[model samples]
Target: MTLRIRHLRMRAKTPAGPYGADIRFASGLNVIWADNTKGKSTCMQGMLYALGLERMLSPRREVPLPHAMTSFLKNDDETQLNVLESTVSLEIENGAKQVITVHRSIKNALVDNRLISVDFGPTLTDKTVRTERRNFFVVDGGAAKREDGFHHFLEQFLGWQLPLVRRYEGSDCKLYLETIFPLFWVEHDVPPKFHPAAS
Candidate 1:
């Protein structure tokens, strides 16, 4: 599955930067070009929200960060951000392209932040079927549930018990990914790989 975001607006009542992040994702590749403390996390948070991740690790927040940052650009509407939108486009394997825009609103309190995503419009044949799954299992988010899938990180951090079914098969089990909705996969903060020579 692939996704693209364009012309997204995540405004606030302060002066920062983008209303939202402009990004795109293709065959296991994603990239974002943003400056320092421009609520880059906010736009990423929007994607996390759009992708439907129940738990999110907000970088840091005050004044509904997105809205607060947006307020800087907004002149006409001093008290509120005029528009906050995130647009996404996808190309299915069958060669069908679809676009979905989420018009968001952050007209609320800082302690009680809010993000409202509106399905702007799209060019697709089927409207009923959900093209994308929302259950976002991210690495940096938080804890995980056993039902979501056998999270090895949970096992590492906490502990794991083998199921009776697996035990019966004489399997001393260790599993990695559960739902495949990897939030960590997007992470590229890694040192270079290497192999040791035979001593």
Candidate 2:
């Protein structure tokens, strides 16, 4: 299925003030460009984080965002402001024209990071969509196959029936999203490798 990201937003509450970014994409190709350390990578990471795909970047359960998101952010005056809480939302559209908005808390006192809320409409783009909300869990066992699992819900939304693959122990397990995503998404932080041709 063709899945496209329609919008992405990252918000962080800080003592100095609120800091964040909101980006909207069109139907076709979209590119983000900015100067160094201007949150270009942060936006990309936020999208993955909101969709519970942060594990594509690492095997650790830790938040993949920079300190600006987890701890503090610097203002235009170069003063560091403590971040109280942070959240990210991603709006996406499937090939069938179905839209959904995913909300996740990256760092918050009240909300658990493992909980992901899904709105069954383009709530981020349209205010009157009357979207239905559902919650799912991630990072726990059976998250990829369980009914209440975020990845399982995501696979259904994308119309994907992942096949089981043989593991090292000769046991079969469904191909996890962590394994499939790397084939489609190229990370900005990892450098490319070059190998010489055999003589």
Candidate 3:
């Protein structure tokens, strides 16, 4: 199936008030080139954060770096405290004439309560559509099931079911979509020799 990203929007909260970054994608390969500190990585991280896959980019440490939402909202000095309220909205279209818009938000709260909104329609260009808000937390059989809200919608939209599989031998872990995303979206930090490792 063909999945195309039509647009990406990011809004950041900082001491200087809120700022936004809006991007539009075309049909073929899209290239983003700029000088150093031009927000290229920030923009890519925003898209991943929007898809609820920011954890893949975080380093394995005792205490992870600032949450993906707050990472980009820091001021130039990076000293003062700035509570970031970030939002990522993505418009995607499948080859089956189905288009979906997924919206996710990050807010400063005690419970880290994230919100997700999904919109579905016949095509990406459709103006009139139906939107729904999903609850990531659900209780089933007296057990709490905290599902990844954004990936759940993405699985349906892309018509691909992510099953539980062992990542390595004798490891009872499953491979997530985010775990394999690096194969498709290679970052610049990768060394030339390891470029073939993803394959």
Which candidate would rank higher by lDDT, 1 or 2?
2
**Residue-level error in angstroms, candidate 2, position 180:** 1.2
Which window of ten consecutive residues has the lowest lDDT sum in model 3? 137-146
State in Å the error of residue 190, model 2.
Answer: 13
lDDT tens readout by residue for model 2, 27-70: 88788877678998889889888888888877898999998899
* Worst 10-residue lDDT window, candidate 2: 184-193
lDDT at position 123, candidate 3: 26
TM-scores of the candidates in the order shown = 0.36, 0.92, 0.67
Candidate lDDT scores, in order, read: 0.37, 0.90, 0.60
Candidate 1: tens digits of C-alpha lDDT, residues 1-199 = 3334433433333333234333444444446545555455665655444333323433343322344333334443454444332232222221123454433334434321233232424323245645433222333323234333213222322324424334456874433333343655353333456989999
Candidate 2, residue 20: Cα displacement in angstroms equals: 0.4
lDDT by residue for model 3 (1-199), tens: 5678788876767676777677888889888766665667777876776666666777432112244356544456765546467666787788776667766665544334345566665223445655554444211111111254455556666777666776556665434566767878766743244455565
Clashing pairs in 2: none
RMSD of each: 12.2, 5.4, 7.7
lDDT-better candidate, 1 vs 3: 3
